[model samples]
Target: MTTISDGVTVVDHPLVRHKLTLMREKDRSTKSFRQLLNEIGMLLCYEVTRDLPMEMTEIETPLTKSMQPIIAGKKMVFAPILRAGVGFLDGMLELVPAARVAHIGLYRDPNTLQAVEYYFKAPSDIAERMVVVMDPMLATANSAVAAIDRLKERGAKDLRFVCLLAAPEGIERFRGAHPDVRIWTAAIDEKLNEHGYIVPGLGDAGDRMFGTR
Candidate 1:
């Protein structure tokens, strides 16, 4: 695997670990697992949004009025990598209720090991908004690359990728394919198993999250 380019951020916050611990267990129930994923997603959101633009604004208090500051423009749209990504949307929406939503679906080609897009939908103003792709796992760069490439085609100039877990192999692949994207992952795992699953990973995050197993 290649090395991490300086721009890819890997967050290791306390709350992230706490919630991740809850989700990692085989005993965790579907509801609990899903909730934990949302909690982790919120933390990921905080880290990924650290560089958002802000501007000053006028404010008033019961005792006094003041000119405070707030986010300049919520020119943001959250795009989840389809079904599994949907698991994170609600929790993040709680934080940025006004943000628009988009969805993209990419599946690995069993034979080719490349990402193939099956579906895509985004807000009409996607170009003007900063886009974030949310997924729980990045085992290989294939899916992420394909999804991001589609986003770029639709006019997303500024983009960031947020995920709960990532493998070194996957990150390296992603970095090579996309030098401009800034990746924010909660933890970087050792490597992908022979089947492309992250080692010591929580296991089929989408299935585990929704209790498909």
Candidate 2:
């Protein structure tokens, strides 16, 4: 497990690693890519919510009474940074069907390489629940940073960031920018390319996911 710093976790499970390898391949079909993304998303979700508060509640079995542990609190909010982020939704939803979803749309300007927001919609009570921001890539950290900023503006307090891959520079920038938010990712690659793309990354996640390119 590679540790970048506090508030960052790299999932070291074999299953996560194996699936990530397939996703990183250039020849992966769109259908297969989407399926692998969902499967991996579910795996990452498990680790992300590992420490959620749980309380024991009284329960009755067919032959006896017992206490079972249940998650304590309002349903979690899944905030996917639209486009590429939507690819992770199905898998996360499968694990947390009751989770509320919020959409944040951001695009990077080629010249400035900065995140520009086009849309933002979230639950009014999002601040009352834990929010997990999902995106498949964290390359320049522009989009991730902006998305979290918007979430905070909308009253979201407890938040976590999850992604499939990240560049070392991106992770460093993000961690420095948002030290309070925990980051979870499958792998942290070498660095960002000249155009702000993660080296050894699976190319444009949005394009691969939707077959746009």
What are the C-alpha RMSDs, in order, of all predicted structures?
A: 2.6, 1.0
- Give per-model TM-scores: 0.93, 0.97
Please provide, for model 2 over 11-69, each residue's C-alpha lDDT reduced to its tens digit, 9 standing for 90 to 100: 97899999999999999999999999999999999999989999999999998999999
Query: For candidate 1, lDDT tens digit of each residue in 1-213?
Result: 122558677777778888887888888898999998988888778778777888988788998889887888756899999768877888888888889999998877777778788889899889999998988898887888889999999999999998888998888888898889989887888889888888888888888877778
Which is the leading candidate under TM-score? Answer: 2
Number of colliding residue pairs in model 2: 0
TM-score of 2: 0.97
Best by lDDT: 2
